[model samples]
Target: MVSAGVYLVVRIFPIVQASVVTMTVVAAVGAFTALITALVGLVMNDIKKVLAYSTMSQLGYMFLALGVAGYTAGVFHLINHAFFKACLFLGSGSVIMGCHHQQDMRRMGGLAKLMPITFVTFLIASLSLMGIPPFSGFWSKDEILGSAYAWGSEHGGAYWLLFLAGELVAFLTAAYMTRLLILTFAGKYRGNDAPTEDFVEDQAKLQSEQENWEIKKYDRSLGGLKTLYREDEEPEKHEEHRHVPRESPWVVGASLIVLALFGGFFGFVGAVPLGITWWQGFITFGHAHHAEVNWLVMGISTAMALGGVFVAYIIWGAKFAVFMRLYRTRLVQVLQAVLANRYYMDHFYNGIIVRGFMVLAKASRIFDTWVVDLIVNAFGAGTKMFAYAYAWFDLWVVDGLVNLAGYMWLGIKRGIRPLQSGYLQHYMLVLIIAAVLFWVVRYFF
Candidate 1:
């Protein structure tokens, strides 16, 4: 589904290529989307939410590549993204189910020791997603970055900004994904087996645990204009439940392993820098723009990705306390709030667009009842009156006329009956009377 739009643009390349304005707009939108979504992923607490935003960011990269006329690069990233992103999603699901529907990463830790297969496969896929070298994502994403830079060099303008934005998005992607791995699998267990009293104490301090608390009360009223109040319900009873997190089933593990393998090595078939053009040759046909791999761009992108990983490790892994102290500052909190709320897009959609449509629906209902229904009812009453008048005419005037005709016919038959009574004298008399009347009329007139 995510690939459909990119595929459409690729299929209609002639039209897209013909318009510079279109290409510029596509590139700008893609770059913006990639940057924004990467920012959003940095603050997510749910494992799946992080992955979801990551998928959107990757799509932005694909569009960015296409926008820069890097058709092969766009398609290459699409295919590689599918492999790694699918593995990541499946691994997240496996973790969720293994933890008995626990998607909150704060409640998960030290899963690597328990779910070995899942850990290995997830790490491999994450490496590819981070665009680490020798992995599939690195080859494709590097190609896109190279293509963007090359396009910008040939076509001077703000188009060069796209390359910088793509590089920034890559750094953020690596940072957040590293943060995810560290939080979910590197730290000590924070889940059901925790000391009961400490767990209860932590749960009671809702302010400190804003992520869990916010989900329960999603009534984010916008300046007292609208309040989305959810129904009240009883809270779940907490008990000292102890269960060890285990690896996913064999089927899930097997699938992850296969995807991890492809995600790990699939890029070898399309290494443009290495002159392995099997993938680009097949996909680009005659329109392929072959260029020597820009080693400078590759080095810079790799440095950015590795720098991101290092930064995430220092912040989330090594100095979590310091990170939290900074996280609690006013500036960071405000930024966090905005990102957590998805930039208030939901509020705008629900409060404006949805409510406007609802008001239009109500107005339509009123018009239908008062105007449409009234007109229809008036026409119905008029038809009923006309039908009654027609029935009266049919019963009295029409029936009466028919009865008068029948009576006249009966009288005429009676008057003519004597002439046909088998009497020759009567017959001759009638003939003579008719003949006398005819002669008198003829002579006088």
Candidate 2:
């Protein structure tokens, strides 16, 4: 659910193992997604949206990892990403609650003190996400990049593009994560609560003293920030206190704490710190190429990660006003505008592809409704008309001929009816007359 694309990548990994062409296609698509999502993530202001694009970007890494035949490395990265990203989401939830459900990072400046536990844990997870050292994400991501380099070195010049793309995505990952941390946890408080008390008073105070009023303590350490549960009071009596965001409940904090710890330290299990074979021994796949660490690839990838973070710090942290002024320039404004709109992907889809498909679909529906239904109705109407004609023919033509023959038979029977009467005198007279006539005729002859 977190990174659904990785499962698709895993399903296609076998194809890469089977055919070279499929591997190339998968790798190319993966590289494209990696770059695209990173660029999309850069201009986002919402915390969850940034993390969502980050998820997509991490999925790109997994796909590219599979592309280079790094099945174990890709799976490892998938597992590690799950732990760290879960921490990130939960921490973001904690921040949202503390800020009264504000999701825009622009409205959130300094929250490191307001939600200390969440901040610390989130920072740990962020570091892991950026592939910082001693973190689970670093171990897995390093292996994936190493696989790309290994593939490129063995294959040819074109295959090297996968490595370059992967490394570029890594840098982008660091940049976005660093930007998120700086904008969220390192600036001044932006809330309107008690705006008059510390209104432009002390700009030199440390992070914790200036931003927070509550005692610096984890809520879970004190039974998850308990309060008296009075049953007799009406709901409206304490309505104001109900929305105040306290530390997360122990159940939620416990999960975050556990995941954060794992995110920070789980890499040791498969760490490749001195060309060690610790991780590869456990993998059952017969990939002998990644048996040891490649220092060049690892070093280059780590340096790029650091460089991305530094770049983010320069833009968002050290010289925030200067960069703000820079962004106001026409060229930077245009770039931000394009990046903010996700390169007009929505416009292309909505104005072109979606509209085109809708037209075709409407045409198909009309054909089905009018044309096909009309033909079916015509067949039904024709069948009914033929039935009516057959009924009339049966009554007029067939029955009429039979009835006429019957009437002729009845006429003949009626004419012969007088001969059937018992008449003895008439018959004897007729016989005598007939005999006399016969003798007279004989004498004359």
Candidate 3:
């Protein structure tokens, strides 16, 4: 949704007029979204979510291609990504199911023995995703790169920047995928305590100890660790053991079949034609044609792919592989650690965006509580006091004035009580006297 919003803004708003800027913005948004989604998915402990994030990241690459106007190449990649990504997700689901809800690769080892079919399917899908030769991903990805290079040549520096970013992203992608493969399939089982060879050994030792105890109970003076027990107290004899490595033919066969098919028909017989001529249009940007195969380019590409495989082998392949022991060196160990941490990209984001936002949030909270809320609360308290004062004034002063007026009226009624009697002559004499007194007082004044 955020990506779509950004796209719309960049499209409708005339401020961002440059095509290169628009494309760059789109690529940036896409890449950010992919990276965020992938990280979230990985942290959430959901197998499906992991795949979803991977798909999102892969789509980011496609969008990057499309933004650079490599439409055909991007579309091709989108299709292939969908195919192999689906296979990978489903295959991973199968592995989870076979492992009885163990989605964590850390809990799994030697599953190539227990769930051979799942392993093979997973291997193929992983290879395809890694862009191994003749797999679906290689063709599409190469096309994207070729188109990016062509665009960079046709345009100016911007396309070149995009191409460089894409290449860097590709290297990271490979590294992470390699890490995933190593942790998933190549390690020793590191799960919780269960039935293992160590457990079996401990159990056998315990039984032997119990048997020896019983023998000691019968024979008081058994010398040292070597004690011959009575017939009744003898340890139960167990059969001899032999270690035999088991192979899952079904899984191996399925893997071999797909790999063989992909190897033989990947470039030439599959969806995209694999011949030199077919790739010529892509590599040359539809400018040139060659009548014969270009073994040189093919060889170089193959060598690069194989080089990646060899690197992976050296780092995390079978224990007996010649260079495997060399990976235990300090330099290789540090390199692996760096790769596993995604070259500190996560740390960088956390330091910049996450920690920055956290600081802003804390500051906002303090401002709201101390500044804004304090001012608002003060105003509210003042308004409430003013209202209370008005109520007090109305209750005391206004009511006191009404009461005084009532008291005056009552006094007038009491005074007029005497005049209510039948005394007209007396009342006229009193009124004449009151008038005489009022005139005397007025003249004196």
Each prediction's number of clashing residue pairs: 0, 0, 1
What would the per-residue lDDT of candidate 1 be over residues 1-445, giving only the tens digit for each residue? 9778888888887788789889888888989999999999998888999999999999899889988988888989998999999999999999986776666787788999988899999999999999999899999999999989998998978889999999999999999999999988897767665445634554445334464445446644232211222222111212144555789989999999999999878988898777888887778835765756899999999999999999899888898787779868999889987997789897899799999999999999999999999999999999999999999999889998999999999999999886797888888998999999999999999
What is the total number of backbone clashes in candidate 1? 0
* Model 3: residues with Cα > 4 Å off, grouped in runs: 1-18, 27-57, 103-116, 156-158, 164-303, 318-326, 329-331, 342-392, 420-445
Best by lDDT: 1
Per-residue lDDT over 178-218 for candidate 3, one digit per residue giving the tens place of the 0 to 100 score: 54566555655433424457445544664577667767687
- Mind giving the per-residue lDDT tens digits that candidate 2 earns over 1-445? 7567677667656555788777777777878888899988887877898999998888888888888888888877888888899899998888876766656677576778666788889999999999888788889999999889988988988999999998998899999999898877887756543333332232223223423323434332222112222343322233334433346667777888998998777777678775555656765355443566778888888998898899889888886787778868999888887987789998899889999999999999999889998999999999999999998998888888888889988999999887666899877887899999999999898
Candidate 1, after superposition: displacement of residue 96 in Å?
Answer: 2.1
Question: 288 in model 2: Cα distance from truth in Å?
Answer: 5.7
**Per-prediction TM-score to the true structure, in the order listed:** 0.78, 0.79, 0.59
- Candidate 3: residue 220 lDDT (0-100): 46
Worst 10 contiguous positions by lDDT, candidate 3: 236-245
Model 2 spans > 4 angstroms off? 2-15, 193-246, 274-276, 287-290, 320-322, 368-370, 422-445
lDDT of each: 0.85, 0.78, 0.57
Error of 2 at 286 (Å): 2.6
